[model samples]
Target: MLKIQEIREIIKLVDNSSVDEFSYEYEGSKIELKKNKGTAAPAPQMVQAAEEVKQPAQQAVQQAPAQTEAAPVQAEESKPAETTADDANLHKITSPMVGTFYKSSSPDADAYVKAGSKVDESTVVCIVEAMKLFNEIEAEVKGEIVEILVKDGQLVEYGQPLFLVKPE
Candidate 1:
C-alpha cells in the first residue's frame, strides 16, 4: 500500500517532469497516473490489486509530439480582435485545487458573484468541493468581475481559470 505522502511526492515529480503517463506494478498491486493538460488539476490516480496475478512489469512511456504546424495556424486565424483588446488588463482567478465548482453556497442560494460585481481580496467567489469538503475560493484580488469562466457544478482542475476580473 502507498502512503498519501508518497503519492503526493510522485504527483509533484510527475508535474515537474515531462513524462505524461506513469505506471507501476508490485506483486499483485497496480497503480497508474496520468497528467491531463489545460485542466489545472491532476487526474484521479487509481490503485488496484489482483490475486494470483503475474509479477508487475514496467511499460514503455510514450511521449506525445511537440506540436503540429497546422494547430498554430488555426489558432491565429480563429482569434478575434476583442479577445486581445482587454485581455492584457484583465486578471484571471484560477482554481487552486481539483473539485466540483459551485456558484452558490447551496442549491437554492444566490450565486456569490456575477458580471459587474465588485470584489476584494477576501471575497468568497465560489465553492470547490473535494473529498466532501466545501472550500470557499476567494478573489484574492481587488477588482470588478468581468466574466465567469466556469459553470456551476462544473469539474474544475487546479490552475483552471474560473473568472476574469478587471482589477481596480
Candidate 2:
C-alpha cells in the first residue's frame, strides 16, 4: 500500500518535526493526527518502511467530513463530463479501492496515461492511495484510453469508472 519512503518521510516528520499533530485537507478528505509517543507508533513505522505508500495514516481519522463535502463537488463537476458518455461503445475502467486517484507519480508530472493513448494488459493506468497505501492499477485489456472518467486526486468508489477504454 504505502511505499516505504513515503512512510519513512511521515514518520521522520512526526519524529523529527515539531508538528506532532499535522493535518492535510484535500478536495474532500481531511487527515488529522494526534501523535502520542506510544506503542502504536512503532508498528505504524514498521509498516510504513515496508511499503511505498501514497496516503497518510491519519486519513482514517479525518475522512468523514472531507468525504461528505467532496461528494457535492464531484457531482457538480461531473454534470458536463457525463454528456460525453453518449459514446457508450467504450469500456469502463473502474477503481478497485475507495481512495484518491493519482494520474502521475508526483505533482507537476505528466499523467501515466491519457485520452487517445494506447495501452495493454500490463500497462499501469494509475495509482490509488488509500489509508496510506499507494496501490497501482494496470490496464487489464489492450486498448486506448478514450476518456478519463474521474479527475486526478478525486475520491473514487470501488468499481467506479476511472477511464473509458476503447479496445484495440
Candidate 3:
C-alpha cells in the first residue's frame, strides 16, 4: 500500500520530470505514476482506489503516440527497395508495443511472410518479441505484402508501421 504523501511525491516527480512513467517499489508495495493529463484522478482514499484511479493513466501512457516520433523517421528512411510507384496502394501493419521485430520464427527458419505473399486476417505475418515473449503479429487486412517496413532485429515502438501491403 502506498501512502498519500508518497503518491503526491511520485506525482510531483512525474510532473517535474520529462519521464512519461515512473515506478517504485518499497516495503512490498508498488507505486506507479504516469503522465496523462487527460485522465482524471480519483479522490485519494484507500491504496486500492488510488491504483484504480491510476489505471487509465498507465494505459494512456502505454498506448500513446508521442513516444514513437523517432522510430517512424528511421522506418521511413529504410523503406524496402521493392516499394516504388505504389505509395498510395499500400496498407500498413504496425507494431503495437516496443519490441524486437523478428522476420522468422528463428534464425534458421524462413520468414513468416515476404514481399508478394498474400495474407488474410488470420495470417501470422511475423513475430514481435518483447520481454522474451514472442508475439505472433497478424495481418489485419487481406493484402499482398508490398514492402516490409522494419528490418529484422530492429527495435520498434508502439504504433510503428511494420509492413506495407497492397490490399486485395
TM-score of each: 0.54, 0.52, 0.59
Task: Quote the positional error of residue 159 for candidate 2 in Å.
Answer: 0.9
Cα lDDT tens digits, model 1, 60-104, are: 122112222232233334447786477679887766555689999
lDDT of 2 by residue, 80-120 (tens): 66545544576766665468999998899899999889999
lDDT string, candidate 3, 1-168, tens digits: 553334545665677887876667666556655566566531211122344434422332455454555666676666555554466578878775567899999999999999999999778988877666577788878989987887899987766888988888
For model 3, state the Cα shift of residue 19 in Å.
Answer: 28
Ten contiguous residues minimizing lDDT sum, candidate 2: 41-50
Residue ranges of candidate 1 with Cα displaced over 4 Å: 1-81
Q: State how far residue 32 of model 2 sits from its true place (Å).
A: 32
| Prediction RMSDs, each to the true structure | 10.0, 13.0, 11.4
Global CA lDDT computed for model 3: 0.68
Candidate 1, lDDT over the whole model: 0.67
Off by over 4 Å in 3: 1-64, 77-85
Residue 145, candidate 1: Cα error in Å is: 0.2
The lDDT values for all models are: 0.67, 0.62, 0.68
* Model 3 poorest 10 in a row by lDDT: 41-50
lDDT measured at residue 54 in model 3 versus the true structure, 0 to 100 = 43
Return the candidate ranking by TM-score, descending. 3, 1, 2
What's the count of clashing pairs in each model shown?
2, 12, 0
